[model samples]
Target: MATPDFVLDLRAKIGTDPLWLCGVTAVVVKGEQVLMVKRADNGAWTPVTGIVDPGEHPATAAIRETLEEAGIVAQVSRLARVGVTGMVTYDNGDQTQYVDLTWRLEWRSGHPHPADGENTEARWFDARSLPSLSDDMARRVGAALLPHGEAEF
Candidate 1:
């Protein structure tokens, strides 16, 4: 896995965890709704995410994952949030700590469906009607909508 953009930047600032350079997540929002995919792996609702591939840009991977998982295309609107957490990586054998870069994506256009291997179900839900989600996904959504954060590419 490669370090997502914001995570790498955050690691520079925080300076301790060598593993801060790790995965990324995306919180895609549309209208008064947000997009969520039921992950095929865990059978749980989560934000669109993937391990950043080597030599690929984080933003590109985020956009790609959004398309592939949720069957929707969106524009990256902001660096909604960055989280420091533990990840049990597939490429590595440890639950080493990670800095997750979560982007807020604005709807562009696309019909919603489960588009790839990662998702089983993909749909938009009313902001108020959001289903039970992982704590990390829920936290990312809250942070993306907060007034204090700036939209960063």
Candidate 2:
């Protein structure tokens, strides 16, 4: 994943110290299919995810990430989950944790592809037959699949 410029600036001052950041996971659905991407960094298959830019709305971030990472245009249906992630130690020795906002999105246009280099592959899979995902990613998907209502915390 590409680190944002603001994060890079902060890293310059804080070194490897843990930083709290906002992020988004976009679970884009079209009928019974869901969009997923294979990460270029770790090869983990997951819903479209990205760091929220400064001052951007989380819902907008979800939509933006979907297009930037997966070549899919989507609109947020609802915020499905809001939670803090476990500490992540990046390959470059940077440590961080994200307050992740997962949103269920409705696919609007475009075919899925790894539009940005952050992912190796992007495609749709049957909601009931998705590829294996990490527990955290699975939880995000699960939250998005629930009946529309208040976001899970």
Candidate 3:
């Protein structure tokens, strides 16, 4: 007899395996430039993103993280993507398995400064002037920033 795979069953099994946290990132664009940060820990330049608090929604997390990490305020335009990311470990023994809900945010107001305890150097670069980044980071900044991302809110 032939059998079909059950998506819900597979999801349930996967969900039970680890601690998951919600995170957000901004594809913050101002004119022809985008904002990125070099993480103090790893020195990898990435968009401003972080984990959502216990009672916070994904959109709220995105806005809060933008202000916290980059010292800039942004209007969350649309949810670019919602997918689970692999467990990323830090040198400090802090490991996170993330269920990232990233969004396309527009530069609304304020200046850039490194705040909150996450990043060190924050700078604006022309989209083309962006530095080499991991593949996951690159995709989240590229195709995900369009208005077509889910409006799940």
Q: Which of candidates 1 and 2 is the stronger one according to TM-score? A: 2
Worst 10 residues of 1 by lDDT: 87-96
Per residue, candidate 1 scores C-alpha lDDT tens digits across 1-153 of 233576556556755434535467877787788888887767888778876766777787789888877788898777877677755454433235656788878889998798866678888888888889768778888877553466432
Off by over 4 Å in 3: 1-17, 92-95, 147-153
Q: Give me the displacement of residue 4 in model 3, in angstroms.
A: 41
Off by over 4 Å in 2: none
**Whole-model lDDT values for every prediction:** 0.73, 0.94, 0.73
TM of each candidate vs. truth:
0.76, 0.98, 0.79
* 151: Cα error in model 3, Å: 7.9
Candidate maximizing TM-score? 2
For model 2 the local lDDT of residue 112 reads 96
**Residue by residue across 23-54, what tens digits does model 2's lDDT show?**
99999999999999999999989999999999
Top-down TM-score ranking: 2, 3, 1
Q: After superposition, how far is residue 46 of candidate 2 from its true place, in Å?
A: 0.2
Q: List the residue pairs that clash in candidate 2.
A: none
